[model samples]
Target: MDLLSDSALMLKVKSGDNHTLGLLYERYKKRLFGFFFQMCKDASLCEDLVQNVFIRVLKYKHTYTEESNFLSWIFKIARNVYYDHFKAAAKNKASDVDELYDLKSSDNVEKEMEQNEKMMLLKKAISKLPDDKKEIILLSKIKGLKHKEIGEVINCSEGNARTRVHRALNDLKDIYLTLEKR
Candidate 1:
């Protein structure tokens, strides 16, 4: 078989080729986990969310159309999974976004410490953003999704996705600068 694109694999999955789901999983597991980790900042929860997304894919497989973009479809499911998880849980117990920060490897201890501090500030800034802005930033900057794909995932027009992303980056910069002063 030729190297199948994500959409192709999903099409196979929709056609009852269950093994294709494994191929899709292998390709996207890390990306999906990273996406979830950025939001929840809990490894175990992110793992569960990833599983939920795939399970959703399976449960909703019949809804998949050949024209649908698989990545956008899966991410929509992920967004729903996140929403459901948060909705069911108490707010006080939500994952602490700060805990997601990790220090970069550096021979100089000072530089490593500085980098870690910066990362924490950035994560905190990102965490402070409103949910819509945060999701746009994650989908655009972190996941490298195009405006069209983001639009599909978020159910907005391409123009709206671009505008939201621009606004989100501006908001994030402002928040980050404010945090830096503290």
Candidate 2:
């Protein structure tokens, strides 16, 4: 079984193949953990959240539809989990923080550090954007999703997704330029 293709694995998983589900979990665990880490900024909490996502997937395997992209379906669950975490954190009066990527063992740590610094600046600039623009940029640039994939995730048409991404990129560029002048 090819583990990387989510749809095929999902079909198997839905058909009483527990091993296929395990394969899917192994394939996505690291990337989804990284995504949650970036979103929630707490390694331990992100770990729990990632586990929760997989657990929920297991518990709700029967709920998955054939027409849905498996990746989008999983991400939608992750998004919901993040929102719940966000709300609970807000209620606890915790400050929202961005998690910085660890590059401690990179060959060129200095250059990596410099690049990460720039990325932090870009993240800050992106966060200042409106919600729709921020979502579009994050989905496209950070998640590396195609326009059609993004549309599937966001429940919009592909054309709308493309236009949204283009406008968001333009707005982000303007923001970056403004920040450069300051």
**lDDT of all the models against the reference?**
0.85, 0.73
Instruction: Look at candidate 2 and give me any clashing residue pairs.
Output: none
For candidate 1, the TM-score is: 0.84
Give candidate 2 regions above 4 Å deviation.
1-4, 91-120, 130-132, 142-144
| Best-performing candidate as measured by lDDT | 1
Q: What are the TM-scores, per candidate, against the unseen true structure? A: 0.84, 0.71
Q: Residue by residue across 1-182, what tens digits does model 2's lDDT show?
A: 44356887887788888778788888788878877655445789889998889878878889887786887788767767767776776443232325443324556778887776677667667656665576566667635478888887778999999999999889988887777678
Candidate 2 local lDDT, residue 171: 92
lDDT of 1 by residue, 46-152 (tens): 99999999999999999999888888889889999998998888772544665445555677688777977788888888778887788788888645479999999
The per-residue C-alpha lDDT of model 1 at residue 165 equals 94
lDDT of 2 at 180: 64
lDDT of 2 at 43: 84
